[model samples]
Target: MTDIHIQPRPVVHQLRAFTPDLPDRTVGELRRLLGLDEVIKLSFNESPYGPSPRVVAALQQAARYVNFYYDPEGRELRDKLAAHYGVGSDYIFLANGADEAITLIAQAYLAPGDEAVIPALTFGTCAFATRLVGAQPVFVPVRQDLAIDLAAMAQAVTPRTKLVYLCNPNNPTGIMIDGSELRRFVAGLPQHIIVLIDEAYAEFVTDPAYLSGMALMPNHANIVTVRTFSKIYGMAALRLGYGIARPELVAMINRVRNPFNVNFLAHVAALAALADTDFHRLVAARNAEQRQRLTEAFTERGWQVCPSQTNFLFADTGQDSAAFCLALARRGIIIRPGHGWQLPSFVRITVGSPEQNDKLLAALRELNGQ
Candidate 1:
């Protein structure tokens, strides 16, 4: 082998245009890094209950046939979803994850110089996808309650604003806009602005004011709701999600979709998870109870925990978030820091099992020097 000096090839301008904000590491990697035997994984809003027993059985049975490719169109899942939402299969578009739907929508609707209006505490993926298409993201600051400031967002839209990103029970902040307010917001927006509502935590929402975007899509052609089985269903490892829109929009986004985007095992798991309504209810109830408990505990201690409808709580720790997360990691717990979101004094903590929550509280108490 000769010593060769070669120049590194630069990535394309589209890729270089923006840096994607995604988790670059895994729980196992972090555990290995800290030389810990086990780490409580609560950084992501995942179901600590895991999926239903049916999903496990179905996946176990499907494991024998890992060599086969799943249906490229994901018809079975799409048909079931269509019926679930009272829509035709043509109105549904499946993808590897909800993030993929966001990307496809941006690709289909956005061109260079276009704009996507989003909240200041917008989900990370929505911003990343918008930037990926070389479109400008016009972010409107949230209200004092940490909910999306829809009026501000509506005012920010112009002729060039192609998309509006709305995250129900938004990530990081975990606050949601009410149904009536959101409808009024949409009504005020220019018809040209397509709304991409990311509803990853929809299943966990117990608030009466919350509404599913899919329920409002029948009359509105501009509405696109992205959902996933990764949260309440505990199938994050499977990477399965979909976009619910009118037939015209689904057709348009489908053009950018890759063939066989959803894997066979994932398709099976999601299918099984749907039929497990009891399991779903159980997880939702547990999350709601735990979320309330955590919020009350934090509030009593003079911490500002935002009211959360999702399976997570965004708390003002009154400390350096990065330092707090590092401390938690060293104590065999994984959590999210808000440095990326520019809230250095805050952290987003996912509601976990009772034991996990207790362990987390203990860690917080120690960090408070109590």
Candidate 2:
């Protein structure tokens, strides 16, 4: 018999120690745990409306190409995106999702001990992506209005600052930095520091003053504007998103992305979704209606709802948000607790269908015994 030898395991440092522990995406998990057949998930900021019929047809048509590999360059989708945005194909870079794009940006630019400036109340993914690349996240607190404090952000910049992440119609808070304010801030920034402008919810915005980052990208070599099909296009499951930047920056980001990062189905679906203007208008109209309804409902319930330009409302619960989410969950309602973003008294609720919004309002009233 041959003697068996066991190899010693290599000692590895705990990378997780430096990152924040993200709570499980509880809305999906809790639904399964309760064995509920149908869940009104107003927790995640997903479009309540499904993808357009044209998108479904396109996916069905593209199913035959499943046996073949997708285009590594994602040329077709890039062309379509360029036509839609009025930019050259070379200016666009496709990714599996906006989250993937965020990671790619981090990989392309961030280094250990370098700083990435972000608004404290913005999405957690930005922070996670920065830390993943061993970069420090300098969180500049928002103004009393819950908008990004552009002056504070400008001051937050230091010699070590490498990237500035600005989520327009900023997540959780749902407030946007004024266009003039952003322009002045960007103009004043050192050319070495890149600005990552995340406009994931731009389509849902009604404010004329809410500028698209693409408008600023042409002049600023240091700016990258990201958009997602997951929000207005109702294609979160497909996980398609893209970024707009100067061709040079796009090339750098493309080098860092996996060749087949965006799947074949997602490419086809995104093209069709972009073409479905009727569906876009419908979703936008419905979103606006629901946003107003939800805001009124919260106001009537004595909750302070943040002024939102996106398809979600961030309500100050005036109590422990974590506990409030738990109480709402027991009643079969789920909303995102704001503790993850360091706001303990707020909860973010996605704008759902009229029926779903009513249910959420009813649940909130019930929880408060109003």
Candidate 3:
């Protein structure tokens, strides 16, 4: 036995300071541990109605192309998306998911000591990415109504701020600024700051007042709109999403972006999925129906439900959510606990299938002593 062991170098201080904040195990693993016969997951906002049947057929057809390298440019899918938006392909950039786009944005523009502006209690990735880049995240607390406090956010910006993240129909809260307000926000900002709009759940939004940040693109060069096929498209397993920004911005992000980042089958299926308009329509309609039903259900029972445009609901849960979620977990329903993000009296639950939503209601009814 030769003692030829190599020592690993210590991680950087920033890396050491970064803390992980996700559940230890997935729903299925937890289900087995609890000996539950079934689990209704309303944590991650995934489509109850899956991708169009055409997506399945297309993936089967694309099985043969798995041996080949994906298009380095991801041109086909970009072209399809461009056509959908009536924008040029130069404005589009693809990533494994919008998650990767967040990292790419951080990598391209963030330097040590730079700060990112974010809405408090929104998705954690934007803040996480800021810390990853050795930059600081300045969180602007949501208003009393549980919507982003735009005034407070603008006031938080300083000379060191490089980026601002706006999650349209913001995750965990589901409130969004309409087009006019968003336009004003962008117009008022310092010209040098880049705004990254995370629209991961845009497709599920139903409120007519809600607006997609996509409209700002090409018009506002500093704005980057990130979208995904993970939500309404039911293609979470196959990570595929894109960023819409000015061509120069897209080019900057691509510099840090690896060549051929999107895989073969994901590319093939995304293109096919885009073509299935009927399924898209159906999913959107169903989500709207469920979103309304869930909101009313909670409101009738005296719980305050934040007015949501997206496919999930955030409620002032009124107790210790950690223990509450564990109790629901024992009954085989998984929901997101909110206090970890600093909202102790809140919980976020996804708009799931009708049957599953009903199951969750029944469980809550029991626990609520209704």
Candidate 4:
């Protein structure tokens, strides 16, 4: 008799069975669906202005080194960032992007059945990373003003809580928590739980009362601050970001993170961009000006615009935000619908150049019939 052999089929359980329910691609797919060229994308919060001239030059020069492997330690870039932030290189860990840093933190610290507290209206990456590590995400709702409800967050912390994510000048909402309130909240938390502060948009902030997690890092061993060159630095394509924490914490993250996560061009570009102080100032000033212009325009149109301390505005249209976004897309304007953040009536618009902002306002006015 011939011996029979059977191959085992892959088993899918509830934990690994879930598929991502991403919305149909807005800009990329919309361009193909409508057969259009030159689509204006304000959907993703990318810098409207490209990278600094110095960064571009450095990228071009660094292209020659593409054949060689990048430095595994990223020592030069880390030293530059350390000097820029007035911290020691031991306190820093570089990642491909701030998003990757979030994932690394979760992998290093979180265990299955652990809890990570996040704002309900946060960037999806924060929540996704927490879940990827088999940790549950406890979403605390925002206040009526659309800012993080610190009181609720304080109450949400339990014995099993491992991480608490706070996005200053938060994504989607573009609002910030006051320094005093944040300080009180952080002080109240148990020292065992780590507070992950995402400050990707910190450079664009104008409020002096807004606390930088970096400023608080010296006092809290469990606090980790993440910054990126993606937004105001205008190097999203370069994908360079760094984290500051206690040396021990940084070491754990480095151990779990991939070696050579940052490419040669990105490393050089970030270093160049950091040295370009004038470019940084220009981008910050332009974003502030455009943010004010967009806020006033939305207010005059009877839409309620949340006060933004970031590079974007969250405007609550009286009508459905998804419908408004679709209508705006038909006119070649791409704004982000807030459905992903469970904000059905709000849309996020990135601060663009004067001409772009004017064009967006005009489009909104036409749509609202004002």
Q: Show the lowest summed lDDT stretch of 10 residues, model 1.
A: 15-24
Q: Return the TM-score for candidate 3, rounded to 2 decimals.
A: 0.93
Report the C-alpha lDDT of model 3 over 57-167, residue by residue, as the tens digit. 999988987878877998888899999988899889999898999989999999888999998868888887888778899989888887788888899999999999999
Q: What is the C-alpha local distance difference test score of each model? A: 0.86, 0.86, 0.85, 0.85
- Please give the lDDT score at residue 99 for candidate 2: 88
**Model 4 alpha-carbon drift over 4 Å, by segment:** 1-30
lDDT of 1 by residue, 226-333 (tens): 999899999988999999998889998999999788899999998898898998898899888899989998898787898888999998888887877888888888
Writing each residue's lDDT as its tens digit, candidate 2 over 15-94 gives: 33433222244556666765665567777788888899999999999999899998889999899889988999999998
Per-residue lDDT tens digits for candidate 4, residues 149-244, read 989998999999999999997987889889998888888899899999999999999999999877777777899999998898888877888899
Clashes of each: 0, 0, 0, 0
As a TM-score, model 2 comes out at: 0.91
